[model samples]
Target chain A: MAKTIITLGREYCTGGRYIAKDVARALGIKLYDKELITMAAKNSGLSEEAVAASEKRHTHSLLYSLYTMGNDLPLGDQVFILQSRIIKQLADEGPCVIVGRCGDYVLRDRKDVLRIFVYAPKGWRLAYGKENNMLQAKDEKGIKDEIDKTDRNRASYYNYYTQNRWGDAHNYDLAINATLGHDACVKMILAAAEAKEKAMEG
Target chain B: MAKTIITLGREYCTGGRYIAKDVARALGIKLYDKELITMAAKNSGLSEEAVAASEKRHTHSLLYSLYTMGNDLPLGDQVFILQSRIIKQLADEGPCVIVGRCGDYVLRDRKDVLRIFVYAPKGWRLAYGKENNMLQAKDEKGIKDEIDKTDRNRASYYNYYTQNRWGDAHNYDLAINATLGHDACVKMILAAAEAKEKAMEG
Candidate 1:
């Protein structure tokens, strides 16, 4: 079978991380999140802490951009280069489910990449955030503000780097609303990913 | 067959208009593009020119945005309201394929709507633009520049209104790369639309 990589691009507090974990365990495959930066740092002579600190912000780190663009930043060119490199480095490490960080466009057109974007409604995301301790362990208003802030940061990072809006649905092979339940989201995505790989094989 | 509405969210040069025409002919349904503006304008009591002028610009003009945080200038909101109304009105009138102006989110959750997004790679889009007289008869570089600018405006409009990014891929039920050839795209999407409608009925 061809090496299959499943990348997850998700909305904040949508249980994207949780679902990714479930899918990885279900498939008996390694999962990636902050771990990607560690692998990239190790393979690319960068630091692990540096990778974590940067995370999605790594898409436009000046030193990396300079190396790619040959000189000073020229408007939008740097973003593409940074995103391209980050995506390449991730794909280079072999098959894994990457949660967010524009792995879809980075590996766009790769026959082996199965890109998934996970999101749910506002009510569901807020509930998930509270349940997962993503907020300050508070009620609706408190969590809503935090969720809004996180969603904005996520959107900005996605927009700045990929120049595409995050969670737009068309960018992914499968878009799931985890509000139905985490288990349900995992089931649907696993089905899509497995079938995609099988189809690729035949 | 029950009435089916096939909405077209297209790039400026992807032959979405033509494919839509083909779909309407094949399915014997109405097709709406810029023409819907007149219908919306009539229904909303705005002038046709005003509707067309605001066709895809969901942003308040620069001056309007400078004055407030958009609580006052309902220009952007107004465009969406108009688009949503028109989309619903069309759906109610019977099946139609709406092109552009954030129709997918507008019709989302509708038991009947099969939203689609059509896209092509840079080279293919440029070629389509030139072939379709959408490129202002420019050289490859010039056409590329125009395509970039046009898409930026489109993404800005879509992002602003839908709170979702244009061409993001995940938002649509079906997305296709039209670089495969216009007729092929038409055939595949027509089939997809039919299949999707069947699923919805089931």
Candidate 2:
């Protein structure tokens, strides 16, 4: 039987990375998260900071450069292309759980891929961020602003790169609310993966 | 333990009704689909045909009349209001599985409700329609048109009534691809509902 690759897209502070890690550990497969950026940097012979900075740049500026510039690709585009290549290469290597970086779009043609998106209600996400001390803002309003900004950036980045809208259920095999808890989320993904594999075999 | 109300929103030809029936059967709960229309019609003292017609009317015409009309409620709005009342009453009675007719929006305030959206790829849905002889049109193009129209109407109705966008992952507890097979979908929903119950208890 062929390996099933799982591509996960998530809203910030949804414990998505933790879920990804757990799923990978349970399946005994490679997990790619921030590691993709490092891989892309090595593949492109650029500094890791440069590749990471490209991702952090506002998408509006990236779009502006994409449309206005001549044949030369924008720094963001160059990094995205490199990362996409790396994602495909890793998927070709074996079954793995990849978080974010538009792995769903990059592996759209693969039959063994299960695309999942994780999100949570605003209040739940806010509370999780505060509880985990993951928020950079001190006050409630500032923390909300930070959360909203991060989500907006992620959406913009995803929208710019993929034909399908980010966070839309149609693009994924499963879109789960993270408030269900990490264990439930991981179990659901595993079950879905097994189901996908069985269906493919039949 | 309190009953968990499951509100399902699904695309055309996704076998959403069948899934609802099976889930309700497995849980030994009442399933509400077309029954809501009949209940609303009885409550409003209107003919069942009139209530059904109100739902089938194009949303654009409904919106136009809604904006133009003075104080009098449009037939569609009246039917919707009656259904909303019936839905609330049903919830008060016991746990049930309600399919479509914006049940998710109606039960949005409830703590024990699980909102699910089921969809399948276009090719899969089209094939399902043909195999089941569910499509009104004979030719492939006409069948495609029929499928598109039904989905469009459902989305328009949902978008018009709810604050959230239709088929958006954020609005649903789980948005699953029906291609995963009905059994897998059912099991995942049951698992999620169990997880939700445990979380609430905690």
Candidate 3:
């Protein structure tokens, strides 16, 4: 039998990562984040650094890049295809929580997958970033620039690979605000997941 | 003839107001913001200050507040009812842009209404707040707190009056990132509005 999975797509500094961790723990399911890099590296025969770097920015012109490279696939394409396979394989093996990597689009056809998008207002994210030292930049302007740049890259990557718009609520089973705090967000997601499961059964 | 109205719901510091203004200018339509308070105050027989105060906080009890005050209605109920009427009247009168006041829900049944939600990543919002001096709070933390609190009040007010979840994509015809800058966002909204109009006609 196939296992049910939950795929989370989140905005930067939105507590989406924390929510995924808590949700996975609560549900007693394996959670995949950076681990997907290792899986992709092993599966695609690429180095871990290559897999990790692909997540940083969207590579332009698969055709031009691929033609020049001659048999070496673009890191973005390799990571996406291999990691997508890993995601499917993990789902087939057991219930799991997959964070980011466009898993929502990857598992679009799966009846057992529950896709969620977690987001919050910008002020909340900014405050969280400052309090946690999650940001690389020291000053507020520099920090904001970094956050904006990172968000843009993520959006570009997701848009490049996915059929659905990133962060659009209609693409997911549920969309929540992480600014409500991690515990509250986790409870809400769990409750929503339960509701989705029951609805599927009913 | 009915007007083609666009209602914008947005996150604080997301430049939603600027987008609304630009959209209104592009469409050559009236933009309702503080003006709605004037309309509600005039119609509800409440002072402008009362209407403005009601906008700031969610009224806890309409019936209880009304009963205790003897002659006064709950600010929430009064504002909601009066503003809803004014929204409808504005739409009926001519094409206009309405921001907040749950204008989408207010005109949910109207064929000519276009609902849009504008959002931006948190860091971008903080930057915008700083650059424009739009935030009353001097420090970053204070600004963030005010933004969060104001958002909570807005969400409570919207959720209380509307059948749909505030900020949920399903409730909107279009959801956009204000980080695209005002001009791009305005163009996108205008294009979407035209597409919607064409769909209606076809």
Candidate 4:
């Protein structure tokens, strides 16, 4: 069987991490999520916390660009470049499910990769967050604001680094609403992966 | 079986219309495509040609909006509202497939409807258009431009009326790349529809 790499891009509270775990386990393949941060820390001299912090500091501001001018690539760019190399390395190593970190754009030239974006309605995501105790806010509005901020940061991070928009359908082979349930979403992705493998073979 | 309404939005040359036909036929339900224009024409006392012409006129320009200010709704808006009403009427009637004319937005409040957006890489779409004799342009560049113009018009049309951005993953339940092949794409949508039905039932 040929390698089929799946890059899963997701919104903040869509149970996307859980779905990625299930998919990797189902396919008997490795999963790369936060491990990319660790790998980047190892490869670069930066500590894991620094690497993670760099990612969180959104770089979309014109003021930020001006601040970083004539300096080494901004911290976020350095982290992104390092992680992109690691993502490509992982894809080269074997079939795996990589969640987040702009894997879609890193592997854009590859024929064997299936790029997927996972999202759900805001209400559904908010409920998931509340049920999972993932919310940092005490009230519904505050929680909703947290969720939107996270999504905005993600879009900002992605937009700053890539030519493509983060959640645009054109950038992905499949963009699925996570309201479909994790099991069903997994099945659909696996089916698409199989079809993709067959297409590559033919 | 409960009714399942499928609204398909497509980029040019993605074979989305054919897939819509297949899905409708397989489900033994009616498919609404160009039939929408005829219905709108009859209900609005306009000719089908007139309605279609209005739809193609592209109402996204600021000047256009300014020109129509404090006046009757522009011809495009009038056509769109009429069609939206017809879309709601048809969905109310029974399970069916509605393609294009922003059916997704028209029936946004319905839980039973699956909003799908279909697109393909530009190369694939161009190849499909050439093979099908769907292109009016004689040169490859000309044909590519034509394809882009069509997509731009669609995005503009969709953006002009709906609060949601066209082609944003948030607006649709599923967005599939047509490179997956029509059969695979159809099967995926059917699977999603079934999952949605079961979810709704529960």
Stretch of 10 with least lDDT, candidate 4 chain A = A57-66
* Between candidates 2 and 4, the lDDT winner: 2
Error of 3 at B57 (Å): 33
Best by TM-score: 2
lDDT of 1 by residue, A1-202 (tens): 3267888877777778889999888887778774563465456555445444444432543445667777765543433455458667667877777777677877876878877777666776786677777777486677888878777877766766665667665566556545445655676566566556665665
Q: Model 2: per-residue lDDT, tens digit, B1-202?
A: 4268988999999998898888888888989995664675576687766676666635544455567885586767767767777888888788888898788889889888989999999899999889888889999889999999888888878876664688999889999999998899988888888788877777
Question: Across residues B70-171, which tens digit of lDDT does each residue of candidate 4 receive?
Answer: 456566666676778888998999999999988998898998998999999999999999998888999978998999999888888888777578889888
Q: Which stretches of model 3 miss by more than 4 angstroms?
A: A1-3, A59-73, B1-202
User: fnat, candidate 1?
Assistant: 0.13
Clashes of each: 12, 0, 1, 0
Candidate 3 structure quality by residue, lDDT tens digits, A31-76: 9985664675576687767676677676554455567886787666
Each candidate's fnat, listed in order, reads 0.13, 0.87, 0.04, 0.72
Candidates 1 and 3, the one with greater lDDT: 3
Ranking by DockQ: 2, 4, 1, 3
Candidate 4 lDDT? 0.84
Model 2, A68-159: lDDT tens digits are 88568766677777788889998999999989989999999999999999999889999999999889999999999999999988888888
Residues B1-202 of candidate 1 have per-residue lDDT tens digits of 6366877888878888888889888888878885665566567776645555564544644344536645554444555566678778778888888887678877886867766677766776887777778768467777778888888888877777666667765566556555445565566556556555665565
Work out the TM-score per prediction. 0.57, 0.93, 0.52, 0.92
**Which residue pairs clash in candidate 3?**
A122-B122
DockQ of each: 0.12, 0.89, 0.04, 0.80
Choose 1 or 4, whichever is better by TM-score.
4
Order the numbered candidates by lDDT, best leading: 2, 4, 3, 1
